[model samples]
Target: MFELTRYDGRRRIRGSIYLSIGLSLLAAMVIWVYPSFEAEVDLDQLLAAYPEPILQVMGVRTMASLGGFLSFELYTFGWIILLGLYLAYATAGTIADDVDRGRMDVVLAMPISRSRVVGERFAAMAVPIVGANLLPPIVVYVGARLIGHPIGAADVLAVHLLSIPYLFACAGIGLFASVIFDRAAIAQRVALGVTFALFLSESLLTGTDAEAIGAIAPMRYYDPNAVLIDGSYDLVGAGILLAMTVSFLVAAQLWFQRIDIS
Candidate 1:
């Protein structure tokens, strides 16, 4: 299991490091520009001008502070969409690529059980996701302090910490897609499509009577703007996100175990 996990981890480490650096730099840039926005316009008014759906989708409530700005500019789109999409794409190839290349047959011929194989590969998928989540908060926090708009350390930590479960859930979705499809390209496309669709569903359904439907989407439980800006921590929401992650992973494991890899 450790060897399998390490194999997957090694495959992803270089790309994960590059992605982490890029995202951290973006977070820093967003934080560094907060003072310019504060000096130039009424952030509350600017953000309020957008429609509720747009605001909800963008995760922009109030840009009146550093936390809010970072939440809107960095965390919402950058973390949720860009990073989430990357993780999903990467995970979608975890099993499908090996299977498609005939590498899975060699592995299955060994002593490893199908469940352990799937679980270890899933663990490999998680290495990059967790690394991607870690560096941004430090960058955001240090940048905020450097610019004289010090966001609370706890708030920054909470935002990044809570994001782990959300990203994990997204990866789980991709993992399911990976096992369901034999081709990596098809699995990637399916994972990306489903992940983005869920995000849109959660965003667009915010105020409707059908909002209950959005509960199925993972983003419904993740509110970086509320957590980072308003210091609101939703333990129930975090729990739900974690539950979804486990459910998706378990489903993927069972499917992989039962399906014909040929």
Candidate 2:
């Protein structure tokens, strides 16, 4: 069981780290290339064009805002897409892959109970997300600090931490989907599709009565600007993220037990 856990976790961590490496490098490059941290032209004018309620929900205040940019640009309200993609790939196929690829029979011959097997495997899948949540900021921070901008470390680290809830939310969604379907492909699609819809809907409803859609997107609650630039952390939203992870994990266990796995 321990071995399986390590195996699963390593696979997930490696793949996610590789995927995020290029993006993190590019972000660091751009941050260094810019003469000023702030964008050109008057950001205030662009900010004024936006609706007040939407701005409040997004926790955005200025045009040259790092908070708004992290939530809006890096996460793009589509962070769920990447998060789900990683989770779906890592988890949706865990059990299905073992069975389809003829590893399940061999594993069952070991001393592990069914529940332990499922639990360990699920844990393995989470390792990658933890790595995903951790690594990129290191790359970005190292680059930023090398350019004589010590604060870039805090900037990248903050936004990446803000992503904690977003990424775990995606992982949970995938875990639940993994328990729901028999096929890895179907599970992946279900998890990714649900996450995509949640975030995409929130973005589309940015300034309307439907703006409440954002509350459903865990990514929306994280104001990267406050943490990254303003240096303030969101304890309340962080609590929600932790709670959501627990909930999804519980749901995955329940459903996995209720269903049959061959």
Candidate 3:
């Protein structure tokens, strides 16, 4: 099981490293610009020009300081949309690519049970997600300190720590799609589309008559802005996200175990 996890994790390390570096740089850039915004713009007034719904969607409840700015501009969209899409894209190929290329047959013929294969592969998918989530907070923290903004350690920690379950849930959805589709590209597209659609639905449906519909989305529970800016960490929401992650992975495992890999 460890070997299987290692093998799959090694395959994804290069891409994961690149993604982490890119996100770190982006965080630094966002942090670097905070002083300029403070010097030039009245953030409250600037944010007030936008509609309330637009502000909510953008995760901009407050922009008075660096934590608020980083939460609004960097973590909310970058972590949610870009990181979510990347994880889905990466996990979508975990099984589908192997099956599509006839590699799954080789893997299955190794005396391993189908359950172990699926479970270990999904475990491997977590490497990149965890790696991608870690580096950005360090960059954001360092950058904030350098600029003298010095965001609260707890707030910075909360934003990245809570993100783990959110990304896992997104990847679990991709894993499910990967098992359903034989073609890697098709699986990836479906995963990406569904991930984005969930986010869109959450953004559009929240605070409406059908807000419960949006509650089905993982994004509905994740609010980096709330964690970082308002200092509000939703432990229950994190638990729900984690529960959804497990549910999706269990569904993928069960389905993959019963399916004919050949």
Candidate 4:
């Protein structure tokens, strides 16, 4: 069933390795610097000086401990926004790039059904998505211990595990874009724009009368700070993200099946 998935998945291995190394390095750097940052700065006062809205937007509820510090300075920015946008941007190109380069015709000429093609290609996104999530937590745990500010092992694990669905949801947005637009450039741009806009809307609109408007955003479901700092895991949110990812993939498959990919 996943023949094309296996073929396409092999191509992403190197990119996945590179992504894992990059994230691990970033995690090491963030963890290494936390002690120095805590020693030099009055984190509470710094946070107080910042506007409340800005703090809320950044998900910086607390910066008092290593867990809180890493949550605010590392995972919230690096994982939630940066990684999410990256997957969205990368997945945006998967199908549309092939179509734009005249490769889709060759792909369609094969015996595979269009829905299977879409499903398998979208399935291949797991290579990078899972790769990026797998190693960073190990780095984070080891780094925190080396820095003498060891965090809860479960918390670190929970945050990474929960992020998978959130990231797939982000990639799902890109998959939808890839099918809707034959031009890779436009698909990528639109995916990035929509993903980022959802982020902004989720961050800026929380607690306001229009907060519900951001409900569709995957960011609404994933809360790194809540997990890392407070040891709070929202399984319900993860399930919602999983559902959203499935919806996007199914929608893309249906759309691709109906469209003329000429």
Strongest candidate by TM-score: 4
Native-vs-model 4 lDDT?
A: 0.91
Candidate 1 accuracy as lDDT: 0.86
Q: Which stretches of model 2 miss by more than 4 angstroms? A: 36-71, 77-80, 100-102, 142-155, 204-214
Local distance difference test, each candidate = 0.86, 0.65, 0.87, 0.91
**Which candidate, 3 or 4, has the higher TM-score?**
4
| Model 4: per-residue Cα lDDT over 6-104, one tens digit each | 988999999999999998998999888888889999988889999998997887888878888888888888888888998998999989999999999
Q: Which model is ahead, 2 or 3, in terms of TM-score?
A: 3
Residues 153-213, candidate 1, lDDT per residue (tens digit)? 9988999888888898899889999999999999999999999999998888888998999
TM-score of each: 0.96, 0.77, 0.95, 0.97
Query: How well does candidate 4 score on lDDT at residue 114?
Result: 86
Better of 2 and 3 by lDDT: 3
TM-score of 3: 0.95
lDDT per residue (tens digit) for residues 1-262 in model 3: 4789999889889988988899999998898888999999999999999998897676577888887888788988799888888888888998999999999998888989877877888899778888887788888877888999888888888888899889999998898999999899999999999999998889888788998998889998889878777789999999999999889888888898888876
Between prediction 1 and prediction 2, the one with superior lDDT is: 1
Candidate 1 TM-score versus the reference: 0.96
Error of 3 at 53 (Å): 3.8
Clashing pairs in 2: 67-225
